[model samples]
Target: MKIIEKMNIEKLNVIYQIFNEKDLLRKLSHQGIIKLHNFFQDENYVYLVTELANRGDLGFLIKNVSPLAINKSMIQFIIAELLMPLEYLHSIGVSHRDLKPENVFVTEEGHLKL
Candidate 1:
């Protein structure tokens, strides 16, 4: 769940960005992308309910795992998984501006989610 405080949104002047993100998430329907289940705004905050990536994110996995354990094939697989969604998004005329390890989540079955 993402809780965006109304005050912070106003302070940061990111109301448009937030709305853009919400729209993008709503339009996206790929296995590698995070699923937005619901969205609502109250008096104090905006709530975004999304799918859970129980295995956490790519950054967490990279930091916790040994470098030697990450083989070339594993790297390729991760990259391929990441690229699939990018390709899909591109085909649909969308570009993800923020692409990073922290933004890539790992699913319980060891699949990657953008």
Candidate 2:
């Protein structure tokens, strides 16, 4: 779950980005994108409940594993999997600005999620 402190909402741009992300997540329903299960705001913070990516982000994987351990086929598969969601987002007139290894997650079953 993502917890955004209400204190940060006083910053107009931060609030805008937060709500914008929520809106984008709400509209997206592709397999490659992270799933947003629920959202709610309390007096102190706003909560976004999402699916758990048990394997963690790609950045973590890359940082800990040996470079030789990641084969060509795996790299190709990850790229292909990433492209599907990018295509889907583009088709819906949405552009993801901050896409990096840290933002890409791996599911328990080894599937990718953006």
Instruction: Identify the candidate with maximal TM-score.
Output: 1
Residue 1 local lDDT, model 1? 71
> lDDT per residue, candidate 2, 1-114, as tens digits?
778888877765588788889988988999999999899999999998889998989999889889898999989998999999999999989888999999899899989899
Predictions in order: lDDT: 0.92, 0.90
Off by over 4 Å in 2: 6-12
lDDT of 2: 0.90
> Which lDDT tens digits does candidate 1 get at residues 1-114?
789999999999999999999989998999988999999999999998889989989999999999998999989999999999999999999888989898898989999988
Tell me the RMSD of model 2 versus the true structure. Answer: 1.8
| RMSD in angstroms between candidate 1 and the native structure over all alpha carbons | 1.5
Worst 10 residues of 2 by lDDT: 8-17
